[model samples]
Structures are given as C-alpha cells and as structure tokens.
Target: MLSTSLRVAILIGIIVYYFILIMLLRQKRLTLKYTLLWLFSGLMMLILSVFPQLLNGITRLLGIQLQSNALFAILFFCTMIILMSLTSIISKQNEAIKQLVQYTALLEKRVREIESCGD
Candidate 1:
C-alpha cells in the first residue's frame, strides 16, 4: 500500500506528463497519433503506479505470479523502441519517394529540352 503522500506524488507526476503532452500538441510538435500514445502511456503509468491492485487480479486470472514491475517496464521500453524503429523506417521511405520525385522531374525537363532542340 502506498502512503497518501506517495499517491499524491504519483498524481502530480501524471499531471505533469499530460501537461508536456498537451504543450507538444499545441505547439504542433506532436501528431495526433503520437499525442494519443503519450496520453495512453501516461495513463498506463498513472494506473500502474497508483493502483497496482488492478494487475493483481490480472495475474490471478492468468495464473502467473510476479513480484516486480521490472518486466512490465521492460516491455514498455521495448514497445517504445520498436515504435522508434518504425518511425525511422517510414522517414527513410518518405525520403526515397521525395528523391524519386525530384529525379523524375529533372528527367522530364531534360527530355523536354532535347525534344525542343531536335525540332
């Protein structure tokens, strides 16, 4: 059982997390999807920190026992890392598409110039 002071501190931390998320969204620095991930992550942490009992029932139902939160934390970190890798992959693809568009435009211009010279 967490002390009342500790519970209040967790609440404050969650509020701060949402504050940062809102600021990023307002500043156009975060997309809607990313903003939602931030919100969900904050909420998940808030719940896990404040009411870990919720997981107790889940563990009971699943017939698994764990004493530490480290595994869950590690899973969350892995998910974040995967998301980062996916974002990088998408960025590289976008760069490739942009380069292709530029090269195609240059080729079209060169072809036009050649046709004009031929006439």
Candidate 2:
C-alpha cells in the first residue's frame, strides 16, 4: 500500500516528467516516435499512482508478492524493450551510413575519372 503522500509525490513527478518531455518535443530535441514510448510510460505511471488499487490488482493477478517488486519488474521489462528498440534503430542507421559512405566513394572515383579524361 502506498501512503497518500507517496502517491501525491509520484503524481507530481509524472506531471513534471510530462512537462519536460513536452518542452523537449517543442524544442525538437526529441522525436515524436521516440517520445511516444516515454509518454506512454508516464501515462501508465500516472494512472497507477492515481489508482493504487489497480496496481495491487495487477500484482495479485501476476502472483507478485509485493507491489513494489511488481512495479520494478514492469519498469525492467519496459527498459529492456526500449533498449532493444534503440538497438534496432541504431543498427539500421549504421547500415544506411555504410551505404552512404560507399556511394560517396564511388561518386568521387567517377568524378576523378571524368576530370582525368577531360585533361
């Protein structure tokens, strides 16, 4: 069971997080696609904080012994999923960079050949 003050604190934290996220988005520091996951996480936390009973029910359903442990488990899972997503994005970007580098080299070689032929 969470104390009233603790729940209030969590709610406040979520609000602050959302505010910061929005500011970053507005400033173009964060992309919409990446921000979606963070926004979802914040919303979930806000909901859980507001309705502690829902969290308790979920923990019970999952057979988790403690609500805090359940919360940690959920957060860990979300972190793992986010990490995997980022890894995938990075892998794709790496391939694209490699392709761009190869194309640039080929273009440079063609340009040099043309210049030599002209001379």
Candidate 3:
C-alpha cells in the first residue's frame, strides 16, 4: 500500500506533468498526435494514484508480487513503446530527408546544365 505522502506526491507529480504538457502544446512545441500518448500516460498515472486498489487488483491479476513492481513494469513497458514509436518516426523522417536531398541535387544539376546550354 502506498503511504499517504507517496500518494500525494504522485498526485502532485501528475498535475505538474500535465501542466508542462499543456504548456508545451500551447507553445506549439508539441504536436497533438505526439501529446496524445503522453496525455494518456498522465491520465493512467492519475487514475492509479487516486485508486490504489485498482493497481493492487491489476498487480494480483498479473501475478506480480508487489504493487510497486507492477507499477514499474507498466511504466517500463510504456517507455519502451514510446521509444519505439519515436524511433520509427525518426527513421521515416531520415528517409524522407535523404530523398529530398537527392531530388534537390538532381534539380540543381539540371538547372546548371540548362544554364550552360543557354550560355
């Protein structure tokens, strides 16, 4: 069971995290699509913090020996998923950047050729 102080801390952390996320979104630093996952994570944390029994039940259902351990496991899994998603997005952007650079080079070469012919 989480102590009262621990629960309060978790609640405060969740609120602060949410505030930061909202500020980032308002400043156009974070896109809605990317923020969705973070928002969901914050909501889950808030729920778990507010209802420790829910987490306890989940830990029991998962056969986890400790509630804290179960919470860590869930957090680790979510982090890995978010990392993989970001990696995929980066990879796609890298491929697109490569293609754009090649296209630009080809266009430049064609322009040079046309200018030479005009000369």
Candidate 4:
C-alpha cells in the first residue's frame, strides 16, 4: 500500500506529465499517433495510483513477488515496446529516403543528358 502522501505525489506527477504531452501535441511537436502510447501509459499509471489494489492484483496474476518489482517489470516491458515501435518507424523512413535519393539521381542524370544533347 502506498502512503497517502506518496499517492498524491504520483497523481500530481502524472497530471503534469499529461499536461506536457498535451502541450507538445498542441505545438505540433508530437503527432497524435505517437502521443497515443504515451497517453495510454499515463492513463494506466493514473489508474494504478488511484487503485493500488489493482496493481496488487496484477502483480499476483503475473506471479510477481513484490509490487515494486512488478512495477519495474511493467515499465521495462513498455519501454521495450516503445523502442521497437520507434525502430520500425525509423527503418521504414530510411527505406523511403533511399528510394527518394535513387529517384532524384535518375532524374538528375536525365536532366544532364538533355543538357548535353542541347549543347
């Protein structure tokens, strides 16, 4: 069980985090698709903080020995998921960039050939 003070602190921190995410979204620094994961994370944390019993139940269901350990495990899992999503996005963007570069080179070569013919 978390102390009242600790729970309050966590709640406050989550609120601040939500505000920051919203601010970034409003500024166009983060797109809605990417923000959804973070928002969902914040919502989960909010639910856990509000209902400590839920965390306890989850910990027991996962066969975790300690609540703290459970929290760490969950955090690590979420981090891994987010990292994988980012890696996939980066790979796709890289492939698109490569294709764009290749097309640009071909176009440039054609332009050069036309210039030589006109000369």
| Candidate achieving the largest lDDT | 3
Ranking by lDDT: 3, 2, 4, 1
> In model 1, where do residues sit more than 4 Å from their true spots?
2-6, 59-85, 88-119
Backbone clashes in candidate 2 total: 0
Error of 1 at 107 (Å): 4.7
lDDT score for candidate 2 against the true structure? 0.84
RMSD to native for every prediction?
4.5, 1.4, 1.3, 1.6
- Provide the overall lDDT of each model, using Cα atoms, as 2-decimal numbers: 0.71, 0.84, 0.85, 0.83
- Return the candidate ranking by TM-score, descending: 3, 2, 4, 1
Instruction: Report the Cα lDDT for residue 82, model 3.
Output: 83
| Number of colliding residue pairs in model 3 | 0
**What value does the lDDT take at residue 105 in candidate 2?**
100
Q: How many residue pairs clash in each candidate?
A: 0, 0, 0, 0
- State how far residue 97 of model 3 sits from its true place (Å): 0.6
Give the winner by lDDT: 1 or 2: 2
Question: Model 2 over residues 1-62: C-alpha lDDT tens digits?
Answer: 76788788878888899999999999999999977878887788787777777778778898
Off by over 4 Å in 2: none
Cα lDDT over the full model 3: 0.85
* TM-score (C-alpha) between model 4 and the true structure: 0.88
Per-prediction TM-score to the true structure, in the order listed: 0.58, 0.90, 0.92, 0.88
Best by TM-score: 3
User: Model 3: C-alpha RMSD to truth?
Assistant: 1.3
What tens digits encode model 3's per-residue C-alpha lDDT throughout 15-55? 99999999999999999997787888788878877887888
